[model samples]
Target: MAVIEYQHSAEDITPAQLNGFFVGWPNPPTPDVHLRLLRNSDAVMLAVDTETRQVVGFITAITDGVLAAYIPFLEVLPAYQHQGIGQTLVRRMLERLQDLYMIDLLCDTDIQSFYEPLGMYRAVGMCARNFARQSGQ
Candidate 1:
């Protein structure tokens, strides 16, 4: 299939096409929670299948719109991997957040190359997780 179109928010998005994401996660968020997180974020970029109108991938960031911002998530469904959809979503999302002074994200070393080409820099970071909160209440 040809690359899908991009949308800014959940305006026409449905949960049906949101499947196959969070691949390999031990505690992945549900589609409904995913929608909540995206909507709650300061910015979001979504890639939708043109013919099917399904969300194939998405990226989200929360920021103060000035000094700093943090990217909480970037995901492309399993079937859509290796097709540059992930990169496209990140490019669009970064564009939307270009005004922010410091844009940061925490990711595994294996995925560092993905962001390097998009103007992101590598940095040390710390994080904490309570698996019980993986699924929002």
Candidate 2:
């Protein structure tokens, strides 16, 4: 297994390194927009391939800095899946948000098992999505 370096800041990252994510979305955000979101996020964790300097996985959270936080995204490139990258990103992000009173995320049932081991539990929640705005324009 190749060594994957994790980073808490996107200071040195470029949109070019953020390829191969948001795999199945009907309208995924472009790498430029993706980088923008990462910059705008309250917290972000990235898993990078030391050799390629490519972002293989990432997780992001938005917090009010006091009572709550919402993790809006967590994804690992298909090629890097099952190598524990996602787990590491989540674990690190959780630790980063440990002071929050409530940390929450919405995931499909299929991936719920993945988050379970990291101390997250299933919950009934509601959400609204504007497909046209899915690309984060």
Candidate 3:
């Protein structure tokens, strides 16, 4: 197993280091836009492979800074999955939002178990996605 380092900031990250994420999205954001989103998010957690210096996983959240925060993204590179990186990313991001009144995210039913273990619960929610803007242009 390779050494994995978790970082709370995206300060020195580059597009090249962010390759291979957003695995199955038909219109995934380009690395440039990915970095831009990371920069714009209220908080982010990254799981980096120490040997390759690549960002293998990340979680991003947006917050009102007073009452609520929504986690919009959590992804792990295909090659790096099942190694606990995703769990670490989510846990760290949740901890960062622990003080907030509400911390929420929407995930598929299959993945709900993943968050349940981390203290998150299932809830009804609605979302609108503009496929054209899915790439976060």
Candidate 4:
């Protein structure tokens, strides 16, 4: 696979490049909505497949720009998982938010180790989910 081209901006990103994301999500957001979310976020990191020019992975965070930040999404296309792309995306986004006092994210228990190596520690957090909102419709 060709090396991914990483860009910090949401410009020039089309719906066609955003296919095949939301893996394992029963009610994942559509590409158009996904673009809206990214555009609305405080910061974003995109991993574009160099060969196909598709968006294979991405991470987004909303922040107060002073005290705290919350990562709302991180996704890597199934075909591109285990290739260190996810880790790199997270690391880069964290660096972007390093000036803040708190950076938080919610993820499956199994993925804890993935973030631990990137200087993130285990923490207890509470969350509420409205399953209906998963589609962002």
- Model 2 stretches astray by more than 4 angstroms: none
Off by over 4 Å in 1: none
What are the root-mean-square deviations of the candidates from the true structure over C-alphas?
1.3, 0.7, 0.8, 1.0
lDDT of 1 by residue, 1-137 (tens): 66688888775566676777778877887888777787888888988888877788889888987789999889887777888899988988888887778989999999898899998988999999888887675
Ranking by lDDT: 2, 3, 4, 1
Which portions of model 3 show Cα errors greater than 4 Å? none
* TM-score of model number 2: 0.97
> Least lDDT summed over 10 consecutive residues: which range in candidate 4?
1-10
lDDT of 1: 0.84
lDDT at 88, model 2: 95
Better model by lDDT, 1 or 4? 4
TM-score of each: 0.92, 0.97, 0.97, 0.96
Which predicted model would earn the best lDDT? 2
Report the lDDT of model 3 for residue 8. 85
Which residue segments of model 4 deviate by more than 4 Å? none
TM-score of 4: 0.96
